[model samples]
Target: MSWKPLRVLTPRSILPALAVLLVLLAGAAAHANKPVPFGDRVAEPGGADASPVTAQSLDTAGLELKVGPGLEAYDPATGEHAWSYRREGATALYLAMAGEDAVVLWDDGLVTSVRPSDHEVRWHRAVPGLAEWLRGEGETGAAQRSETQRKQLAVERAAIALYTVPEASPWVAVVTPGLTMGFRDADGDLRYNDRPAGNCAYDPVRTVRTNYAVLVPRTCTGSGSNNHQAFGGITGYRLDSTNWQLATGPAVAMRALDGQRVQIEDGPVLGSRVFDTKAAAPESACGSRTEVFAAVRPQGTCAEPVANPGP
Candidate 1:
């Protein structure tokens, strides 16, 4: 009976509690429906542009794409274009997501960093030797060059590719047939320029970014051997220290996997095994025996092959 004279809940006190509950419920629902980060989204194959070369998703913002003439960012939810950049004669050779920025490698050897949010060109840098190579090609008439010369030039051009290392501070690594260079993400300043060691010709096929390293899988052909007989292996570079080393496991071409792992064919009968890069050096028994014809990233784990193999 002494219990407070049947205390009634005051509207003021109850109102605040109700408001907080409603707010939390709204927040939880909003969070549940929130768009995932663009980088987390698996890029689709098409976009609004004709012959859309590539379409990359930006999660909540939209999808960025390399259309026929330029690069574009579109709102996937609304199917509305957000931003685009185009030039008279520019072709995007490669498009990669670098954190919040987009790193585009042009056919002319120009590398541009664009902020997808506002379509701002953060910085642009020209790859070494590309300008000179282009100029040389322009200077020579098709009739003046020998067939062998033309073929060689074509091979060299084909060897040029872009590799974005998100583990390396979102740096863009330009690997040419002759040399490799790394650039800073913030300013596009040169970070390191060095040719791969050894007399073997290194044709970089793909780059894999681990949690702490950047791995480049290259076909290495000895100086005198035909490039067709190249062997595949990866050169691992420590992102923090910038030190380069060869992977300790088998030379059989391996494909990068999520969670700092790689999948390589164990042997003809053994099928394949997935190796974690973060683990200690691979066992010596994992030595190279079978040739991995392709050094591309597998779609998933060892179960699937590369859906879109790199050049």
Candidate 2:
């Protein structure tokens, strides 16, 4: 809900998407009802010509700093623009170092990598949704969200986090409203595999180590928002040594609640895990052979366990 200029720091080994993280408070629907503000990305007034950003660190390594609109570099020290990229609708988010190349990005998706010296395109890809879409019900909703999602997307706003570990793979955390949390490798491959549920937030518990655990929140189906409905258990996924290299696990039965406690029965789970095949089986046998994880309730009991495909 606050807007501050992104500061350029000396490249550190690890960086969280400091300027790119978003938090959703409880009781807040996942939609554009009470929209959170995406802060502006400009320097404070009267301090525009105060300092020059030279370099900064990202999830991978230290990247040189140059300011510009697209796949180009701007010299704050010299006030000169170098390098250029041609894209239909390019949203300049932040610049990071990808190996030895300067990577230009607007959000979780990569735009192109350029050389700092000449702004030459090393690698490039088309990233969709440079503009964040927040569709409201009608006129009123449109006006409320228009001031937030629209204006931010106009500037190509991005929510990014960077991190690194010793002897571990480098990773970048990205949060796009109404999208899933995405973790990208230095090579640009999505290390953290998650399908957008149209809504998501970055949680380090599952992402930092690639647990591949599928989180299944018990669904509560109720008529109102005050009923006491709960779920049988939680589900998750793990990497399998065989098969699709991923296996499902038994459900960790936990108490589930409706968002309003009244809509429990009608409130289905907003989280899920995808499976290659949709077949009914014992909860314990789920982790045996599957690329994805799912939940299976027992015959006599309402509670279920997370499933695995192949072990």
In order, the Cα lDDT scores of the candidates are 0.57, 0.34
Summarize candidate 1's per-residue lDDT along 1-311 as a digit string, tens digits.
46657768998879989999999999999999886432122222343353444343345235645443456666676767665665445555456666778887665667778777666777878777654453346554856888667544533443345666666467777766457677878788887776754654345555555554556655554532455444445666543563545532234555666657766553474456655555423322222343243242223434434478668
Worst 10 residues of 1 by lDDT: 36-45
Residue 33 lDDT, candidate 2, scale 0-100: 57
Q: What is the TM-score of each candidate against the true structure?
A: 0.55, 0.35
Superposition TM-score, candidate 1 onto the true structure: 0.55
lDDT for each residue of candidate 2 in 16-105, tens digit (9 for 90 to 100):
443333434333456645532221123222222312122232322222254333443334545343324434343455565534555555
